[model samples]
Target: MNEQTKKQYTMAVLNLLQPKIASLVKEAHPVYQEDLEQELKLKMLEKMQTPFLHNIPSFFEFVSSNEKK
Candidate 1:
């Protein structure tokens, strides 16, 4: 794949991880809700250089791939 495609893939992976990561952070450090939310927002924005896909394959590809491995 091209560089842009690779970046998109990485961002897609990060986007998939955001909720789990944020939850882990919150669980580990319960007092940091505001900071964790802010950081998660920034990280999500960084991943979402393009608008996110609402369609099925684009949204679920990462999760499905993980399950297969």
Candidate 2:
């Protein structure tokens, strides 16, 4: 995808995950929440570009006790 399209896709994905990101940022310092959310979004966007997304894990995989490295 082109840069613009990749950016649009990233924004869409960020919008879809806004609630989850908010929840994840809730524990962060109030002053840093905004920055934390932006950083998390950037990280997620980076991950979205990786081969890791090809073999995506189930949602349960994240919260499970037996996570693989």
Candidate 3:
């Protein structure tokens, strides 16, 4: 992805994770809390770069895939 798209994607994911990250850092030592939050955000952004799926499955497609166990 281009730089602009990549940055936007990172920001969106980080925004979604902000609350969870805050909670996670809350229990950390006061001196380490900021560092812990930064590390968590960095890790999440790194993982998001990995490919997940190119497209979402439609209802019929999902049904067919799940049929016959």
Predicted model with the maximum TM-score: 3
For each candidate in the order shown, give its overall lDDT on alpha carbons. Answer: 0.71, 0.86, 0.84
Any idea what lDDT model 2 has? 0.86
* TM-score, ranked from best to worst: 3, 2, 1
TM-score versus the correct structure, for each prediction: 0.42, 0.58, 0.67
- Per-residue lDDT tens digits for candidate 1, residues 1-69, read 587886787778777887787776777566787787768767766755554543336548978888999
Summarize candidate 3's per-residue lDDT along 5-66 as a digit string, tens digits.
Answer: 87897898799889989999999999999899989988887777667632567889989989
Stretches of candidate 2 exceeding 4 Å from the true structure? 1-5, 51-69
Backbone clash pairs in model 2 (N, Cα, C under 3 Å; residues 3+ apart or in different chains), count? 0
Error of 1 at 56 (Å): 23
Candidate 1 wrong stretches, greater than 4 Å: 30-69
Put down candidate 2 lDDT per residue, 1-69, tens digits, no spaces.
589987798789889999999998999999999999989988987889898775666779766836654
